[model samples]
Target: MSLARKFATVGGATLGSRLLGFGRETLMAAALGTGPMADAFYAAFRFPNLFRRLFAEGAFNAAFVPLFAKEIEANGIDGAKRFSEEVLGVLFTVLLVITIAMELAMPLIVSTIIAPGFVNDPEKFDVTVKLAIVMFPYLMCMSLTAMLSGMLNSLHHYFAAAIAPVFLNLTLIAALAYGLWTGADPLMTAWYLSWGVLVAGILQMAVLYAGVRHAGMRFGLRRPRYTPNVKRLLVLAFPAAITGGITQINQLIGQMIASTKDGAIAVLQYADRVYQLPLGVVGIAVGVVLLPELSRALRGGAVKEAANLQNRSLEFVLFLTLPAAGAIWVISDEIVRVLYERGAFSPATTATVASTLAIYGLGLPAFVMIKALNPGFFAREDTKTPMRFTGISVAFNCLLAVSLFPIYGERGIATAEAASGWLTTVLLFVTLVRRGHWEWEPALFSRVLRLVSATVVMAVSLHYASGYLADWLTPQARLLTQLTALMLLIGMAMIVYFALAFAIGGADASMLRRNLKRKPRPETAQEEADTSVLPPPQM
Candidate 1:
């Protein structure tokens, strides 16, 4: 399969999920606004996501994929299947215990991890605690889901895992809509969303289970046991967890600092949702497809091929993500207003989120590049180097956020996020170069410069459109009207950018033209090619 095809398989599935998520958040903003309910819900949401990142998705994947790939290569199908079952057995027991314990300790977790939002308001505080307890169990279900996802990914079944998140968004949307229709309290609706998360995890796992079965891999857990492989996985995962924790540490630090200012945390959270859409789509899709592929290459002693995959992954990511970053930066306000300004969401909140979104836009490509690059290290089973770099980058983020927060407030948080993204990218590049893993190719550099130049043209054009829209902002303007205008303006900006990019040899014009020269499904075929993973072991 071609690289583009692989990306499309993952990217197309993920694009659906991201769009649904946008709808879910749009409804949440309409229903809850930036008030107490929003705060409580986001807080509850973040707690599970933190663990999900640190364990289920992050450290686990970093450590598990490479070993799984190797076991399949050396020990064959049954060996890899046994390894998976053993890992799942131990993970289920441990995560179940952790979930119950965390639920029991929800109050303390909320109070310390991100307390300031609810500290002065007892109602918000209590609601967050209860909601968090309901949501905490999601970790257990999702942990199991992640294990299934990892297995499917190792088997090159990226579609199932990529498509699974859509169910989560659909569940939440349905829950939120039901709550609204019934005229229930928003807090109750938030609790329903929490339960919806657990439901989604189950559905996701079930879907991947089917995929695994189709691929002729067994999916089940035995009674818990700490086999040597399990123990090795546990040991390897600890540092990988720290490496995974690095990205979230920026958010945690920002949340802590944002707590000092009224509404800042919620503002940051809202903007983050917008930022997460693209990051989740491109970054996560690339990471998921690349990791197991890199693992297989490294295990087979194909170092040069592994590097080539990295290089191509870099090219593919830069091709797609750089423009996305540019578009978001160009129309941050319109994007915010279109997705958010309804129900209780005010114009002021839109403005706040928009500015923060712009800052986040600046870092989007770097974030995706980091995602694509990290697999190179993880596939080599060298978690320590990335861990060290992540630790340093996260520390830099903390210092920058602390130094800037007093004056910049929420924007400081945004600035810190952007700075940390670039910081990590630079560190990773240096590490790769020093180790003789990565070096500049003139063609790649030239392509990147073209992308930047095209994006600059896009940004300048969008800036004027934004200014023109500002003239229409009046107290009497309806939210729908403002949002509609914003959408139209953004659409215009994109058309102009696409046209200019093609004219100037900027974007993926040549690729698109060549693709057009092929049959109708050419893009789809290319996407599938890019997503190919390890060949399943012989029966």
Candidate 2:
């Protein structure tokens, strides 16, 4: 399949899941608002979710995919299956031990890492601890699921793995719908949400495992042993996990800091979910497809192909994310209010979330840049470099978040996250350039600048369009009016951005079709930098 098609398959599925997430969060806003119970649940859930992102989605795939691809290359499906079973046996055993340990240490975790801020309020502290225990087992299920998802990705069956997350949203939405229907109190509703998390984790893992089977791989249980392969996986996985899950690590740091203030955790989470839409669709989609594709090119010693993957994927990411950041920055208040400003979500809450979302918008491109760039390292089996940068970014995030939160509150936390993301992006880019992994080309820079120019025009237009729609976006307006006004703003954004991009040579459908329609060829260095809409970069 073409790169764009693969991205679309995964990105389309993620879009569905994100849309469902919006529904789930919308109901959650009504059920819990930005109340104490809301803080308790989000804070509790963030722990397991953090590990889920770090290990399952980030670490497992980063370390496993290239190796899995190698097995496929060396010995075909049977060889890969044996390697998978070996990893699975060890993974299952390790996850079981970790779950047991976390459950036992839940209180200690809550007191220290989970939410030290809640300790003064004995009631809230107790609730966070209990909720975390109920949800922490999710980490195990998702970690295993991550393995299965990686298998599916390596096999090029993107849809099933991508679609599994929809079940999580479906399960949670059902849980929330039931709670809201019963008019349950916020605490009871949070309990429902926690159990929903556990159940959804199991469901998502099952779907991915079935997908692996369908992709012509199946396995039974094996003894958990530290084989040479498993040991090597561990060595690569630990660092890759840290690098892959950098965003979550930074967010976890922000969460710890945000916990000290009432309602801040949930507020940040709401904003995080909103911005995660574009990240999941574009950034994550590119990362998933690019890793396996790049690994294949490198494995075959196709330097030109690998370089094209990096540069073309970069083009694809900026093509989508720049305008999204613009939209979020331009009409954050309207978007937040439309999605969240009802029930327990007051206008004051909307203001805070909007500001946070806007700050996050500034970093969206950088946030996704890591996704496109990291594969440059992982495909070559070098995980430590990205890990070192992640450590630097996390530390910067911690220090800056601490310094800024007292001054700007939640917005300060947002600022810290955006700044750290840009820092990481610059670090990754410079490293890739210095090492010659990334083909730093002037045409790419020209396109990026053009994309930015187009985005600025769209953003300026959106500012005025939103101002004109302010009355319709007000709380007094009917729900339909709010929805219409918001949709209209989004539609205008798409129409304006894409047209301007194509007109101004920021994008070329023909060139994209030519370059990304197939893997790069040895003779296509000129094609890689064809003077279609713009000339090739000066050497």
**After superposition, candidate 2 runs with Cα above 4 Å error:** 522-539
Off by over 4 Å in 1: 466-539
lDDT of each: 0.78, 0.91
lDDT of 1: 0.78
Error of 1 at 111 (Å): 1.4
lDDT of 2 at 16: 99
Q: Estimate each model's TM-score.
A: 0.90, 0.97
Expressed as tens digits, the lDDT of each residue in 92-116 for candidate 2 is 9988999999999999999899888
